[model samples]
Target: MNTRELTYVKAFNEGMHQIMAEDPDVFLIGEDVAGYGGVFHMFDGLLTTFGDKRVKDTPIAEQAIIGLGVGAAARGLRPVCDLMFMDFIGVAMDQIFNQAAKMKYMFGGAVSVPLTITTAGGAGMSAAAQHSQSLEAWLAHIPGLKVAMPASPYDAKGLIVGAIRDDNPVIVVLNKKMLGVKGPVPEELYSIPLGVANIVCEGDDVTIVAIGRMVIEATKAAQALGEQGISAEVIDPRTVQPLDIDTIVTSAKKTNRVLIVHEAVQFGGIGAEISSQVQESAFDYLDAPVTRLAAPFAPVPYAPILENAYVPDAARIVAAARQLVERS
Candidate 1:
């Protein structure tokens, strides 16, 4: 296997650069994304390389950023708008939901927006309430917007390429915690289709469905469970909106037990949707109830200790999955 290490941030940056060079329609617009290289430095040198036309920077207004992207997209341009934080999606939901999302359908599928809205979300690093949020569930409920949460460097590259090429409005959430993570990634340009689930690790005892940064935590927990004689499967639903129910349900049925994990609050997170879908799709095959591991319903605390507690970690996932295995 061709293997090496690369941070998640680099993979995204490289992939964005590659697509922009190859496709004239592909461009980026966001706050500090061009000249400033973005808050996380994901687009550090892109503006210099692609010039102002492709690497455009805009004001801090979320609505205007998204509104401009919608107009650009409707004109056959593939515009990727960085929302900075997924929490700010609330401010631009109208442009995302009412315009970019519903445009093609409203026009009888004759026009395609071909837009990708990429944002970062998570509860680590003490970004606190205004910044840290796992809001994929909010956008996934909309019919026209595609939601993708890539967990690894490989997925980060492939999914971004896929999102840029997609005809509908897509929301790609890059968890702040996972940006520095390194993993084996391909050098060639490729695409991970929307609505696909990646089974990072597989076992027969229990299936763990994780999103974004939680996938790494779930894998670590699965290893710990292995030491205790529990075989846990780790499945990352790369795209939540176009959820791969078939893949997840099949894995759950084979194992007969399932655990849903995410960085979002327990209430109304994507974990509930996965849990409900598992129960509905594989109800007869389950040996035990599906359990979920998620942040509690509260703002993320700034203190390191409280912040650690606020986000679901490897230990908690191990404990939760082990309890389910014991019951089974």
Candidate 2:
């Protein structure tokens, strides 16, 4: 395991760079991704390294960008398309949900859509409503689509590498708040399977299942709970669609309490599905109802204070966990 300190964005760059270097068919396409190195600098020096043939930039059309990627992927090219912001997925919903996601299934598994969609998600840096949203649940709801929400640098690289090699379409949602976050990641190429869950912290009192940026908040909440003699286990479901429900059920059974956290809204969020699964699988084991900590069902606010309030934080998660643990 050749590991080194790296930020989340840098880890993603390493993953794409390694794959593009090894495979002649692997290339990148999106807006400003080639020359400007992407809005978040995910493709920093990739254009210079790979040149225009592989790292071509497109016009400001999300639909066209994704449509081209789906077409390219169908033609045996492993295209890593960056959509800039997850919010723009709405413009390309037809291409994503209808075409790229359903092609292999519609063709009786004869054709493959090895397309990887990378985009920035979550409410932070005051990106406002249109630019900040965690819409992974929307993609996860569609069949034949794999969704990956990496919380750390290691998972970012590993998941991206894995997504690039998969035979189906994969949406890799990078939490924008985590871009500058640093973690120890392996320098070598590594691919973490899509359905595996990482039990970040082990405890007995409660289970906290967090996705994307919420994982960091959940971890902090776990630490705070520990100080108060309340042990909380933290679980990160690296992939949302092919969810690792077994690990989550086991954790929930052991703790007898579960608290789900995500940057998405509370109503009809991914947490609802996870909560239902846990209730069905470990209902007898749970001492209290499954609680979810998430943003309100409203557009992301522009003000810093409102945006902060809109996003679930460590304190909110801690309070929710405390409630679940203390409920009689």
Candidate 3:
């Protein structure tokens, strides 16, 4: 594979640009996406490369953005709609959950909404409650939508390509905190299959299943646990909706303990679903109850310190894993 180091944001930009060049039907429409290169610089050179026709900018309306994407996708065009922030998904819930998500089912599989909604998520850099939030659970809750939360630049590039190729509506959630994080990504276009979880690290003591930015924390926690002679396996559920429960359950069964971590609020979060599935599949194999390490049920704070406190770090994950593993 031809690979090069790229930041998380750069990898996605490369993937989208590569796809747009390869497929004439794929286009991007969102607020400030063209001339402004997107709010996060996700479309820095896409507009100039694809031109105004394919890289059209839209009004400051999330509802209109998603509606246009749904309509375009239904009519046979692959549209990548950037919502800017995951928190804004609430504004376009009808278009997402009701329209784009239900198009194929509503049409009795006669139509496919091959639409990809890419948005930044997670709390860090003190984006505050309005702009910072990991709402993957909300999208995953809907039956028709596919949710992919990429933790690294390599995965970001591959996942975006897969999302674009998908015939169903896919939500690509990028953790804002990891925007600058760099990793080696293939120079050529490639796709990482959705719903497949990556076992980042193998261990036998405890299993830590993390999503998005939390994947980094989970790995760090695993390293720390290793120093203490506690082998902790880290699994990154790259795609949350079509969750790879088998991989998670298998790891949980081997480790006999599991810790689900995410930047989103613990209550009603995706962790709850993962924890429940693990328990159901590996109930007899588990030595302890599944532990969940997630942000408390509260708005993301604006202050850096508060934001740090709100999101779980490696230390917290390590502590939770130790508690889970040590329980007699």
Candidate 4:
């Protein structure tokens, strides 16, 4: 495979572009997506490449966009709808939670919606609480929705391609902070199947399960911990819904310690689900408590300093892991 460095947005655009060209049924719809190329330039020039019909834009309505995508999906067309910000999904909960997510099951498997919703989630760029919330947990809790939060550019393309190709609805949230981060991405189109986890780093001391933007910080924490001779393994669950619990359990078993990290608030977060799963499956392997590194249970603060404190950083993960190690 020919590989090259690409920003997260570039990788995402390339994946969508490649999939659209290969699949005649695949199309995209979102606000300002056609002419403006999306709010974050993630859809830059896609309108020109795919034209108005396939790269259609809509008014500022989240529910309308989901409705269109759901209809298209039910009619055998693969539609990738962009909500811009995942926080807006709250406004369209009925469309997502009641309709799009449950269509196939409700229809007794009469049809499947190869529907993919791409949005920006998690705080880092000071987008404030409205634009920066990691709601992967909310989506994952849904019976029929597949939730994915990619960490790096390489996985961004592969996981998105996989999500769009799946025979079910998938929610892929792109963290804005990672938009400009560059990493190795293959030139050819491919997919990282849903429910798979990547062993980003291997160690025998601790297993660090990080999602979205927290993966970058967790990686840094692992590197710094290496200096202290603390071996830490990092695992990124490419798709949160289909969890890939086995990989996490194996990693925790190997390390004997588990530390979950995410940009989401601590209470009622995805980490709790992961922590529970690990404890249930790998309780005997843990030499210490299953720790967590997450933001407090509060809205994302707008001030830079407060936001910085509100988000999990490399230092936070490192310190948490260090504490757990000391306790063990």
lDDT of each: 0.90, 0.93, 0.92, 0.91
Badly placed stretches (over 4 Å) of model 4 are none
RMSD, model 4, all Cα superposed? 0.8
After superposing candidate 2 on the true structure, give the runs of residues whose Cα lies further than 4 Å from its correct spot. Answer: none
Q: After superposition, how far is residue 101 of candidate 4 from its true place, in Å?
A: 1.1
lDDT per residue (tens digit) for residues 44-134 in model 4: 8888988888998898889989988898899999999999998999977888889988998989999888899999998977889898889
On lDDT, the stronger of 2 and 4 is 2
lDDT score of model 3? 0.92
Cα lDDT tens digits, model 2, 1-328, are 8888999999999998998988899989999999999999999899999999999899999998889989999999998888999999999999999999999989998889999999999997798999999998899999999999999999999999999998889999998889989999998888998999999999999999999989999999999999999999999999998999999999988999999999999899999999999999999998999999888999999999999899999999999999998994
Model 1 agreement with the true structure over 1-328: per-residue lDDT tens digits: 3546789998988889889988988989999999999898888789999899889889789999999999989998999999998889999989999998898999999888989998999988888888998888888888898999989999998899999988889998988888899988877777899998999899999999998899999999999999999999999999999999899999998999999999888899898999998998899999889888999999888899999998989999999998888996
Instruction: Give candidate 3 regions above 4 Å deviation.
Output: none
Question: Which residue pairs show backbone clashes in model 3?
Answer: none
For each candidate, how many residue pairs have backbone atoms clashing (under 3 Å)?
0, 0, 0, 0
* TM-score of each predicted structure versus truth: 0.97, 0.98, 0.98, 0.98
- Residue 171's lDDT within candidate 4 is 93
Clashes counted in candidate 1 amount to 0
Enumerate residue pairs that collide in model 2: none
